[model samples]
Target: MGSAAPAFYGRRVPLFFNPLEAAAHRLSIAPPMFDYFNTLGLHALVAAARLRVFDALRERPSTADGLATTLTIDPRTAEVLLRVLAGLGYLRVKGGRYRLTRTSRTWFTTDSPTSLVAGLEFWERTACVIWPRLAEAVRDGSPVTPFYELLESDAALSRSFQAWTAALARRQAPATARIIPVPRDGGHVLDVGGSHGLFSVELLHRHPGLRATVLDLPQALEAAADHPRLTLRAGSFLDDDLGEGYDVALLFNIVHGLDDQEVAKLFARVAAALNPGGAIVIGDQFRDSLMPGRASRTLLDLLDLNYRVATGGRVRDFREVARMLRAAGFDRPRHRRPLRSVVTELAVAVVKSPSRP
Candidate 1:
């Protein structure tokens, strides 16, 4: 009947059925389900990082049972975790032994120079906890827990935040120092909202003639290392008087947390704090300058969401930033060469002389 309906595999098939089309349909339908489970891989990776699995593997390759014995984890659990990590390309497995891949060795090992363990820890501990409340943030148009308020309530979390941020800052500071133009002549540098002060320290190292003053919360500054060329000022960037006549001012990774008015006010304060010929270097991730890739765009969007949830702030577009800087009575701003990092592009803007009459 009807030419046997193109029977295949001893079953009748629809006359219009196409194998390619069926395969495409299957793929289209599978991604959402696949994506849901894919996220679990990220969580597992973060957990393994926290548990120092990579660190243990860094010492030497070991069978899952051996690793379990060394780390005091269940053997079956360790094997499963190791298998997952191997599947993810962070580890290599052969002869029932696992070892860190070059990628993991470079980034996951605690002792590696470019290790990202601290930054990853920050994501696991802080951002991961907050992300579950994203729906509430979307509904309320803000994060369920304000970032600063959360820090205020939890001393341990606050310390962890500082440590992770400091670690991340240290990783990027060298590249940032290379890109930004520091005046050759010795001049005072003001770091507004410079929590860890690593940027200032790196800059001071680059320019021995310069001295830096870091203004941030007392808790954030408590862990800052003492330096002959560095001074730590404890207070709010919003209410505190940023002392005047500094040759250069830094507003690094600070603008995204503030609303437009606060950002404008901050620029005004920075303008007031600088010497007539001084420059204010604003270092942040400008939305317009993000790297050209789908991954980068996705990351930028996530960061925008993160800011929106945590502080009712957003990643500023370059045009908006320049407009704000102009409104704050600074001359036209110039963008320096951008430094691309794992998280965001380190964008630097140098404002011409302050317009204070």
Candidate 2:
């Protein structure tokens, strides 16, 4: 018999095996690389831009020394920052002079409509700090809670939290508009933890028959009084009693930021508020076996970790959520894929029989 090669080194015979399977296995197990590279470049860009490096460059393409003179920075430090930007494909260097690359021209211009500078500034000031506590959060349970604890004395931090929450709602409003379902008739829709009523506004716009009630912190509500079509209520889910007789209740990106007990209480509350045959729609990231391309639970797991540390909450699996729904009086839960990123799962549960209630 011929000598056998080690398993680590594929033999000539093994070469005939399927390459696709091998590639798939490798990809499945490999860690995400260059993860910090983009963030590093962003930080550098923000720092350099704040120092007026981009403004100086726009004025004229000059050597590092001349650029430093204009910006009032050390020539070596300016050159280093310029090189970083070049490596990130934002700038180009030739013969010791620099100019904005084509990629930067469109975005870096002062009056460009697509400027992401403000968003970048927001991330640098807030998100960056919160991300580091993700591990600690995962072990504890709430991403923002722990962060708030750390910055409890800082009033600005508290304001930033609310601001970012609204900003995030606005950013995803378009995407959420596409996925969320609107009732055929003027059915009542309850928005749990929805900020600024953006999703409600979209729901109303998309489905003329749909009326919505947005439940959020008192300060988060944009409108006063529950209108004939649209209503905004101010109260915490834990303390306030949920109004009854909702045809559809929406929990968007809310449950994941809560622990099991809190989630149980929320589902129970939602069940109590739901009318007969009414459905509860949950929108969030979940671990799904069927939806491969649509799932990003792993990337979101980091966010889960942050939530854990910050709020004492966690993202639950589909089965876990289903069980919670069932315990809260839901019948068989149904899943839907109306959009990407936001998984829409519905559970129709009985609150109480007419004989009992």
Across residues 72-180, which tens digit of lDDT does each residue of candidate 2 receive?
8898888898888876667788999998765465455444443444345545755577666656655644354444344335545444455555444555556666755
Candidate 2's TM-score reads 0.64
List the candidate 2 regions with Cα displacement exceeding 4 Å. Answer: 1-39, 45-155, 158-175, 222-229, 289-298, 340-357
Which tens-of-lDDT digit does each residue in 131-162 have in candidate 1?
Answer: 78899989988666668767767767777777
Q: Give per-model TM-scores.
A: 0.86, 0.64
- Model 1 stretches with alpha carbons more than 4 Å out: 1-27, 119-121, 339-357
Clashes of 1: 1
